[model samples]
Target: MRDIYSNVLVKQSLTPAVRTATATGTAVDRNAGGGAMFQNALVVVTTGVITDATHTITVEDSADGTSYATVAAEYLQGTAPAIVAADDSKTYELGYLGRKRYLRVVSTVAGATTGGAVAALVVLSDPRVTPVVRA
Candidate 1:
């Protein structure tokens, strides 16, 4: 079998931002493959604390990264541990088939007492094109 790593045209795994306060994370353009959107992308959110918190993970897109919009109907693929503190992770499909140029993982979280942090991963691919590094 051929090396699977070569098939991945663009890939990035980032914590993006972690919350100790209520500040929403800044944009993560990553500039993956010169914002080609490639074929598809995968977004995975992993929680750390998640104590009595509510988090909405959504995928957003933009041309200038100044004004953005949601991509999917149910873009928010998962929620925080509401009932039990188990299952503190989720993976969402970031379908870039007909999406825009710039994409980012938006993690909006809120808590009554305190405790919530997450690390996210994004992977993009397009067999015909090569990955580009943004300036």
Candidate 2:
């Protein structure tokens, strides 16, 4: 098996919590570890106890951390999901093929009094440097 723990750097884009409103995740720098460049990225979203709400997950990228925009369709490997109650206790993964230096995940929730427990992780892979250091 491949050594995933050593080759990949994982960043918490969204904090795990019950979100009643929109959640804007933190940007993760692809070159954070010793200026090592990465060629691939994956966004993983995990949910629990979804109520009467529709959560639309958007994947964004930034050339600079201050400015962000939605990732283009050509740069995305899979579509961002409009997560519903039926998707409770499930995980979703989206691959990124863009060459942006920073990335994040945002969840937009609507039509809900009680929201859901949602969180996202940005997984940076194919690092130029081996054994990704802890950040």
Candidate 3:
């Protein structure tokens, strides 16, 4: 069992750049690691805004790549009131103790005409259910 992670970061970016102002991001796949399973995930969201904006970021999973759904048991820790500042950040810890085979992250921004930018980073710890590399 290899537990220590070094040299390589155990993280993935959901979107290439900050989400478009008042736009939603297309789901980006994270199962490329080819692992059979992962136990926990830490989703870090970085936000920058000029005025009021309601931004909600969530993590979703799927058995198949085409369909996705939010894990009902996990949620993120963030400020309840809408953020209307230059810099706002939060990290969500989620546990995927189910049999879902695929995962992705998404964001929703509202209440801003000229919205701000938001970025997401997900650090997933693979439990290595199978513990074997497949080609």
Among the numbered candidates, top lDDT falls to 2
Sort the predicted structures by lDDT, highest score first: 2, 3, 1
**Clash count, predicted structure 3:** 0
Number of the candidate with higher TM-score, 2 or 3: 2
Tell me how far the alpha carbon of residue 67 in candidate 1 is from the true structure, in angstroms, after superposition.
Answer: 1.5
- Model 2 earns a TM-score of 0.94
lDDT of 1 by residue, 72-97 (tens): 55543343222213435444444444
Q: What range of 10 consecutive residues in model 1 has the weakest lDDT sum?
A: 76-85
What's each prediction's clash count?
Answer: 0, 0, 0
lDDT of 2 by residue, 4-98 (tens): 87678888999999989998999999996666677789999999989869999999999989999999889988788888889899999899999
- Against the hidden true structure, what lDDT does model 1 obtain? 0.51
**Model 2, which residues run further than 4 Å from truth?**
none
Higher-scoring candidate on lDDT, 1 or 2: 2
lDDT of candidate 3 over 64-88, digit per residue (tens): 8778786565343432223354444
